[model samples]
Structures are given as structure tokens and as C-alpha cells.
Target: MIKTIIFDFGDVFINLDKPATLRELSQLGDFQFNNSIQDLNNQYEVGKITTEEFIRSYHNLLPQATEQQLIEAWNAILLDFPKYRLDFVKHLAATGDYKLILLSNTNELHINWIKQHISFYEEFKSCFDSFYLSHEIQYRKPNSDIFEFVLQEHQIQPTETLFVDDTKENTDAAQKLGVHIWNNNPKADDVIDLFTSKSDLF
Candidate 1:
């Protein structure tokens, strides 16, 4: 039985337009969504660099865009955090039957935007027993170490936890450690359906 739940933030609770930023950037230069970009993204998410430095990389690469334009382009991917999902998680958290954790691969800029735009950001956050942000924690998902860190920190048994993520690679990594998982399809699935869809686990 699952006594603990680890959820990925983007696509799991908050929606993301994963390609929006890339598409917007492509307009300014010959940007190949290649290793260089991925490397930079990884560094930013893990808090290896400051948000200014992260923004400067884009400004340097796409010289035509100003800092404001770059910041806007970078934040285009974030969308709304539906109220119903917030309600569902809050109710689940209130039950106190399962340990609730939110693990997200995100950077300061995105978080800052959420805090500014989402009115209930703090309230939503209070529901989690533990909240791990990649930038703050210096760890990102799809990496075995991050999953291991969470397990060790919470003193949780892998077999007794359920991890829900929108990405297959992330879920695959967690499953290797014996954690049951839901690789939620963002296009068709909603986090609000967690109880009904994964009823057997509950």
C-alpha cells in the first residue's frame, strides 16, 4: 500500500507549455534545442547559477532581445494552477493518512512569477509535508540521486511510496528504486483525478 506520495509540480499540478519558450526564442536566432541549451537549463534548475546569470546567457545568445524580452520569453511556459486541484490536494493533505511531497525541477524566475501571479501560492504550498524545488535543493529529476535523496530524507521505503510525474524518464528512474509511479499524460490526464485513476494504490 502507498503511504507516501511524491508529485512533480509542472504538468502534475501547474500546467506548462514546455515548448513555448523554445518557440519564442527560435524567433530571435538560429537556436537548436541542443545540448548547450539543455546544459544551461540543468545548471539553472540546480541553482548552480543566479537568475541574472541565467537571463544573461539568453541575452548574450540572442543579442537582439533586451532583458525584459528575455525574461518574458523565458516565463512563457508557465500557465495556471487550477483551483480544483488545489482543493483536492488540500483535502488529501488534511487527511494526514499519507505523506505528501512536491518535488519540482524549477528555477527562481518561474517561482517568482508564481508567487506574484498565483494568489494562493503559499496556501497551496502549506499542504505539502515537504516541498523540494530543484533550484533550492540543488537536485533535478530523472537523476537517480535526487530520488534517493528524497527517500533517505523522508526515511521512506521505496515500495511504500507512489511518485507521480508527467515525464516518462523521471517516473522510470523512480520505479527502478521500487517506487510505484504514475507517468501522467499531461495532454489527457489531470492531477485532480489522482484518487479515481490510482484508486488501487490508495
Candidate 2:
């Protein structure tokens, strides 16, 4: 009875080195991933700050790092979008069996980089019935509002919807709202195995 699938963009589809950003930033002189930076990132993810403001704020914090360097480090977390994953989703979309939606907590810089680097980005996007980016939507995962928004926007029954996210916090949040979930482990889990992996739901 699962009529809809909500997918997380990072890790679930694209490869991300979650710690890579901080690892790259540590190369900059005396840089620390502190609470202020974390708060700034959260704000940026929800579109509270513009990309220029985000870079400028980081540059202010780490005076030793140039804006371009900061941008490069920030984008280090994004690695690659595999062709097979794109093919899988595209095939799924072609069947029109379920409502496909993409929900990701990402920022402008990250998406801009994908558009530039991932040649099939547009094709990948077309696979989804609705694409919701945290920054663009002014909401983020692991929060009730974003989940509620998606559910209400689509008029999808929680019992008939499955949310797949690499982050447990996000899946847990959706689960609380009665949605079925797959807390996928990116290392061992491939989204293309959706039917076999979560066969009980389908």
C-alpha cells in the first residue's frame, strides 16, 4: 500500500563524505568547527542566509581562509552521483507506480555545485514528482514542520508513504508522524535495491 516514496538526496542518492567538509576546513589555520559555525550552517540550510552572507560569515570567522577556499571546503562533502542510481530512479519514475519526491536539507552552494558538476542533474530532477530543498523551502529534516508540509502538500497518507533517509534523526521524526521509513545505511545500502530491501512495505 505504499503509494509514495520520499527520498533524501545526500547519501541516499549522491555520495557524501559527511566529515570531509570539516576535514578540509581544518587545513585552514586555526579553524575549529564550533557551535557558532554549526548554528550558521543550520540557518543557511533553511535559507535564512544568502550564499554571499554564508561565505562572508565564514571568512570573518577564519580570517586566514579566503572566500573561495571556504566555498571549496564547504562543498567537499559532496562527492559523486552515480549513473546507476540515476538510472534506477529514472526507471522507477517511468513506471509511474508511486509518487516520487526528493526532500533534502541542502544549501545553495551545494546544489549550485551539483548543477555544474553533475551532468545528469536535470534528468535526475525530472524523475521526481516534487523536489523540495531545505534552503529553498525554508525548512529542514528532523523537524516536524518539513515533514508535515510534505505530507499535507501531497495529501499522502502517512500509512501509505515511505520516507528513506540516511540520517536516523530524520527518519525518526517522520516515523513519529506515522510514516513508514527506511533508515538506509549508505555504505551497505543501494537505493536501487528498494524492492528487495524493503519488500515488506511494497
Candidate 3:
């Protein structure tokens, strides 16, 4: 029986236009932004750099842009959180059918943006038994260690925990640790459908 549900925040719950942000950033300066931006992003996610440092690095690259402008542009990836999904997750939590948890590979700037925009963040997060953030934990997704840490911390049997993530590699990593997973592809499938189909398990 699945007694626990793990959810990824970005893309899975909140919408993110990753490619759009990259494209916009690439056009910001005389120099071209390529795969190296991805490397910097990975480093930020893994807690190798602070948000201030990340913003400063970008500002240095794009000397023509102000710090505030660069910061806003960096956070442009976070679009909005739909109300329906928030309601659905709240409904699931209210039922008391499972131990809910949220795990996301998010950085400080993105988190601050959410705090400023998403009014229901506290309410939604309160519904979960635990909320884990990469920056806070100094660990990020697609890393087997992070998955193992959650399992160990919660004393959850991997087979009885279901993880939903937008990234394939993150899901794959959790699967390797024996957790049931759903790859939430917004273009193909929505999370509500997944919950409805797997209602019996909950």
C-alpha cells in the first residue's frame, strides 16, 4: 500500500518556462549564453553558490544590466501556480489518506519570488508532513543520495512511497531506490489525472 506521496514543486505544481528564460537570457548581452548557463544553474541548485553570488555572476557577464534587472530576469522562469492544482492537493491532504511531502530542487531567488507571488504557499506547504528544499538541504534531485536521505529520514518503505516529478532523471533516481513514480509531463498529462487514476492506492 502506498502511504506516502512526494511531489516536485517546479513544473509539477508550479509552471516554469525554462527554455523561455534561457532564450531571454541569451539575448541579454553581446556574448552568447549556451550550455555553460546550464552548468551554472546546476551549481546553484547544488548549493555550491549563494543567490547573491549567482546574481552577481550574471550581472558581471551582462555588465549592461542592473542587479535588480538581472535578478528579475533570472526569476522570470517562475510563471504562476494554478488554483485548481492547489485545491486538488489540498483535497488530498484533507482526506488524511496518506503522508504528504514536497521535495524540490529550488534556489533562494525562486523561493523568494514564490513568497512574493504565491499567497497560498504557506497553506499548501502546511498540508504536507514535510517540505524539503535543495538549498536548505544542500542536496538536489537526480542525486541518489538525496532520495536515500528522504527514505531514511521518513523511515518510509520505498515501495510504499510514490514520487511525482517533472524531470525524468529525478523520477528514475527515485525508482532505483524502489519508489513508485509518475513523470508529470504537462504537455501530455496533468497531475489531477494521475491522482484520479491512482486514487485506490492513496
User: Which candidate gets the maximum TM-score versus the true structure?
Assistant: 2
Write one digit per residue (lDDT tens) for candidate 2, span 1-202.
9999999999999999999999988898788777988999999999999999999888887899988899999999999999999999999999999999999998999999999999999999999999999999999989999999999999999999999999999999999999999999999999999899999998
What digit string (tens of lDDT, one per residue) describes model 1 on residues 69-104?
788888999999999999999999999999999999
Q: Please give, for residues 5-63, the per-residue lDDT of candidate 3 as tens digits.
A: 99999998899898776666766776576688778887898788988889888888899
Q: Model 2 lDDT vs. the true structure? A: 0.95
Candidate 1 lDDT for residue 138: 98
lDDT for model 1 comes to: 0.93
lDDT of residue 61 for candidate 3? 83
Task: List per-prediction Cα lDDT, in the order shown.
Answer: 0.93, 0.95, 0.87
Candidate 3 structure, TM-score to reference: 0.93
Give all TM-scores, in the order shown. 0.97, 0.99, 0.93
Candidate 2 residue pairs that clash: none
1 against 3, candidate with superior lDDT: 1
Worst 10 residues of 3 by lDDT: 22-31
